[model samples]
Target chain A: MEGVLSGAIGVLAASGIWLVLRPRTFQVIVGLCLLSYAVNLFIFATGRLVLGAPPIMPRGGFIDPTAYADPLPQALVLTAIVISFATTALFLVVLIASRGLTGTDHVDAQEREP
Target chain B: MTPGPEHLIIAPILIPFFAGALMLIYDERQRSAKLAISLGAVMAMLLVGVELLMRSKGSALTGFNDIGFYLLGDRGAPFGIVLVIDRLSAMMLVLTALLALPALIYAAAGWHRQGQHFHSLFQFLLMGLNGAFLTGDLFNLFVFFEVLLAASYGLLLHGGGQLRVRGGLHYIAINLTGSLLFLVGVSMVYAASGTLNMAHLSLMVPMLPEPQRVMLHAGAAIMGLAFLIKAGIWPLSFWLPTAYMAGAAPVAAMFAIMTKVGVYVLLRLALLIFGAGAGASAGFGAEVLIAGGMATVVFGFLGVLASQGLGRMAAHLVLVSSGTVLAATGFVLAGGPVQILAAALFYLLSSTLATSALFLLIEPMGREEGGIAALLALTADAYGLDEREENRQPEVGLAIPGSLTVLGICFAACLIVLAGLPPLSGFIGKLGLLQALVASGSATGPMAWIFVAILILSGFATLTGLVRVGIQTFWASDGAPPRVLALELAPVVGLIGLLVFLTIKADVTLGYMNDTADALLRPSIYAQGVLGAPRAEDASP
Candidate 1:
């Protein structure tokens, strides 16, 4: 499960990097979204996969200290998701402003020197 | 009695957010009210900050528990968010306030005339910068960073000149990438360690596996990259001088404080999370930092040599200073507690003083530019005044206290101090750093020698260029170019006064720095302070 998840994360990262390098403004935004997703997944996988459960600690049941999944990563991911959302919104607003002001969506629209 | 320091930590972030919200409705044209509101908030922050520092210094900040929305709370009360006011963080908050006050004052002086909603954005930026410093949780740090960046976007583009717009775009683009990675890194740390509580992460970081550990390192590296881009370390620093050059002097000064926030976080992570086995061996990003810092210093010197006048030269010098601090901290990290702490503290104090002075200097330098240019132009029209006046512009306009040469000399002396010359705080910092490096026993081989060579070379280069600037501007006989005005002298005097203050209190300040360092080296104290002493069950193997 870890391998597959991290593999998917790798693909997301590559695609994100490629898109980020593109000249289009929208592409950069898309790239940022993709990279964020990849990063979140990568972090999630680092908790050492627990097949039987999400990190909720079972009570009144056998307390297998080893079996209890770590809840910290989940908590961290939740916050990361929210931050990424805000960042995306910020990017959208800035992208629109740049377009309105410069009349171009290309990243290098303002570049003059070769 | 009063709620503990942990709760007070929230005020630094919360007060500004509340005040900034209030400022949004503030009349766009009511410059005075905006100034009052911002200044009022800053003073309040300073007061609260000093209180927190005093409290935290005495003992643990004590974490938060159940207090929902009130500005203050306890450190151990673990629910919504915990704000820990450790010595390291407390010091950073004080530094931020110091930089913020002047930058705001500079802005108040008429910089806003060229921009819109200046106070609103400035307030928001303050909120972000403060929040980043005070946050005890990793995710919250990311949130504050975004807040700060969002505010910066507005300020960077506030004036809307073509050059500014271009620089703003690049600045925003690079940081957005950084933000994305920052999110990822925090998430990874959470996954590996199962906690975003910085203190908890400190305990868990050393226990992770190889592949997982490497991934964590990568996350840290990526996060470091974001900060590096922000801090204006060499290679990644390309955007800094350009963006800074385009902004008004006051805005640039405020932004100078922004990069140090990145450096602060970088230092925090290196000391707290990445100091051990896999993390240390992975080199997470220390080598890059060390190399980049040296490069930044070299690049800054070269830029200064190649540049024409004061403003641009000062901008490049800031980049150099940023690198010097980063490099010094990197070297400091290689040594043990006592030496590293002393060195880091000294360097931080001197760096802040030098950087602050340079920022203030820009305002006068800008004024002088016009005066000096006009003088030279007049001399050309005169055909042949005194040869000195003909060859160099003389004091033409105002009655400056010293010759442009003397003023230039003072500025050069300041830079020499910045580059770590003896008898000044800069030298003390550099000397302490060298001693730490040597004592670390890590300085004997090739890497150490290379690092030393870079330090010495960068030092000499900075001195040579700065002295040359002094000679050209002040020493060279120029027909009296322009008498300096009070406005020009005021900021320079203020900066010099700060330098003098640092010099006089050097022993006391260095003592405090050492104390702070000792506190930082023992992560256990920080952990105990932020998180209630670990449970006996948790300690069980």
Candidate 2:
């Protein structure tokens, strides 16, 4: 499971970097979304890949040290997801605005003469 | 439980947050109400800042050694979020309030009306900056950083022109990538240490085994990259000048402090987590920081010379200021005296104030074409007219208009400060920094001398560039003086006056800064202050 998850993250990040470096604004926005997804997954996986374990302790009971999954990374991933989502929305609006204002979808907001 | 004065640590964040949210309810046409609320919020923040500064100073004087920790939801450390206030954070809070008040006043003059929700966005930006300065959790820091960046995006695109849109696009793209890197670094650190609380992490970091130690260092280095990018170090700062030049005057002025936020975080974390006590991770990225900072200074010097517009020149000066402080931070990390860091802090304050005043002054300085036309007119007046006509015209001496006199004086003051010339805070900052650097016998290697050379050379470059622009704008111009509003003029004068005040109180301010630096170098005290605080259940009646 760890191998598969790490491999998937690597692939997503690789493709995201490629797309982010492309000239088109649409590609760049899409790339950011992909990169954010990879980051979210990476953050989630930081909790050490526990399965069938509670994320929090049951009230007033003897607790085994390793019986529960680490919950902090999960919480962190949630925050990252929300922030990345909002930023992506903002970036898309900016992309459209630049496209309309400058009459181009290039990352520079203008096309090269070539 | 009812809140008390102890809760004032969170007021800097909460006041702006509530004010911004409240302003959202008011209609855009109700500009007066929004303006009043924004001003009131800033004033309240300034009061809170002064109170916090006093309390921190009192703590230092009484030898209490307590770094004020305001635990959120009354939870103890390593679990809940915390807002930690020391002399350094208190000073930063006050500085932000000071900068924000003038910028807010200037924006209210006319720039605030240029776009929708300017007041609310401005308030939110303050909240984010304050939160970033005050937070004790790494994740909270990231959240606040995003908050500021989001508000900045809105503010940057506020008075949208084609240039602003293009500039805003690049700024958003680069920062978004930087945010991703920040997340990656943060999560990596969490994975290795199992704690995200800064004080907790500091404790855990020193005890990590070999494998996790490498991961921690890697995560730290990546995080440092994100900050260095924001701080406008060389190669990563190409987008800064353009983006800053593209914003409205007041917005750009406010941005003069944003880069310092990056420097502030670097100093805090480098000393807290990677200081002399961090075992293998001590002084992790000092060499890279020094080399990069020196390069940034050289880059800024060249850019300042190459820039034709006053706005662009001001933007490059921001880089020069950031580089100098950044290099000084490296020196401190590499076992130099803490006094060097304190001097850099002084320089940071003076440079930020000067650059901000310069940004506010740019719009009133008038356009480049106007200067050219004025030069043409002056040449025509000099030679085109008959000798008798020329002699009859100025025998009464050039009657400098009141506005022109003010602008010229302010321009010259900015020049004196930025160029590290005498009789201003800028020169004092540089002198103190150089003295500390040279006087530190232990760390005065060849690199230190090279940094000193860069500092002096950069100051010379600033003098040349600013003097050239000053001559073109003032000495050669023949156009009618640009219209200056009292609201706009007051802030520039106030900022310059503050610099003058800093110069006069140099000894006192330097004394405070030295104490702040001494505390910063001792992270163990900070860790204990946060981690040793009693839980709500234990403390409450």
* Winner by DockQ: 2
Q: Write model 1 residue lDDT over B1-541, tens digit each, in one string.
A: 4453345657888788887888788766677888888889888888887776666556333331111122123224234466566666777777777667777775654456455677888878888988887776787788889889888888877655455566777777788788776766776655555567777777666777777677667667767777888888888877777778766666777777777888888877776776533244423456777778778878887887777765566678777767777776666455433665577567766666566666666545445457334433433332232333423533323455754544564576578676788777788777777676666664433555565666677677767766666666655745555455544445555566666677778887776777777666556666555566332334445
Q: Judged by DockQ cut-offs, is candidate 1 incorrect, acceptable, medium or high?
A: acceptable
Segments of candidate 1 deviating more than 4 angstroms: A1-11, A37-82, A85-106, A110-114, B1-6, B59-80, B209-212, B276-285, B368-413, B438-446, B471-492, B533-541
Residue A10 lDDT, candidate 1, scale 0-100 = 91
DockQ scores of the candidates: 0.34, 0.82
Q: What is the lDDT for B125 in model 2?
A: 94
**True-vs-predicted CA distance for residue A46, candidate 2, Å:** 0.8
Candidate 2, residues A1-114, lDDT tens digits: the string is 999999999999999999999999999998999999999999999888988998989889688969899888889999999999998899898888888777899988778998
Model 1 chain B weakest 10-residue run by lDDT: B63-72
DockQ of 1: 0.34
Backbone clash pairs in model 1 (N, Cα, C under 3 Å; residues 3+ apart or in different chains), count: 26
- How far is B222's C-alpha from truth in model 2 (Å)? 1.0
True-structure lDDT of candidate 2: 0.88
lDDT of 2 at B20: 100
